[model samples]
Target: MHEQESTRLGDEIVRLVRMGARFRGMFKTGDLGAEFSALMLLPPLRAMGPMRVTDLAEFKQADPSTVSRQAAQLVKAGLARREADPADGRASRLAVTEAGVQACERVREARAAMLERALADWPAERITAFTDLFEEFNHAVEALLRTDPTTPPREPA
Candidate 1:
């Protein structure tokens, strides 16, 4: 890409991210409450089964303290539980509860429905093309973040 095109793309990505955050805030699941920040931790915990705060922080490229606080919220909400780490009796790992799984599904369905309504006028082929391109863009960004030592850890915007 040319320098100008790269600059434009970067700007658009920033705008898209900001808009997405706003849209996410609009989604309210009864199980998780209206605060989406803490709920973000559920997906990784759900996927990884159980993980220490530090491990989850590293996986998410977020601060360990932040992850710890979020995990606590999950625990308080009964969406997740802390369990003894099999390898280390002294340490505990956070695991998503069955409620957490259901909450995640609800959130996913809500988001999908919203997207479907928003894209109702778009052709199926266009939607598929956009999805493919968006996934490619996300993978490229992840690769850059992984390889670039100078890249800073992500924080809530």
Candidate 2:
């Protein structure tokens, strides 16, 4: 891509990202502060199944103390619980509770509602095309990570 085109792409992505962040903050009305931590589950929990608090901190780019406390709050709220990792006696792992699963499902519903509202008139093929392009873009990003593992990951769009 030409320099100007690359700049425009980045600018557009940044605008979308800022919009997404604001929307999340504004529309998370159903969630108590406790339920807000539910958003933190998808990445770490999805990839590693049950992960240690230290691992969750690294995966979520959060401080260990904060993750530890939040994990405790999740436990108290019955959203997630800690387990003894039998393979590693010293490490504790976290898994989402049934209530946490329900919360995740609620998040999915909200996401679907947002998409439906945004694309009320969008053609089905356009949605498919968007999915394809996004997957290709995701592949390119994974390639970049493989090429430069030390490069910090960009903020999501």
- Model 1 spans > 4 angstroms off: 154-157
Candidate 2: stretches off by over 4 Å: 26-29, 32-38, 42-48, 57-70, 153-157
Cα RMSDs, all models: 1.8, 3.3
State the lDDT of candidate 2 residue by residue for 1-157, as single tens digits: 8999999989988899789766676553375336455456644574468888877877665667777777887787777888998889887899887777776667767777887888989999999999899899878977786688697754321
Q: Candidates' lDDT values, in order?
A: 0.83, 0.73
Q: lDDT per residue, candidate 1, 41-150, as tens digits?
A: 88878887899988988888887888888888888888889999999999999998998888878888888888998899999999999999999998998999999999
Candidate 2: count the clashes.
Answer: 0
C-alpha positional error of residue 41 in candidate 1 after TM-score superposition, expressed in Å: 1.5
Query: Candidate 2 local accuracy as lDDT?
Result: 0.73
Q: Work out how many backbone clashes candidate 1 has.
A: 0
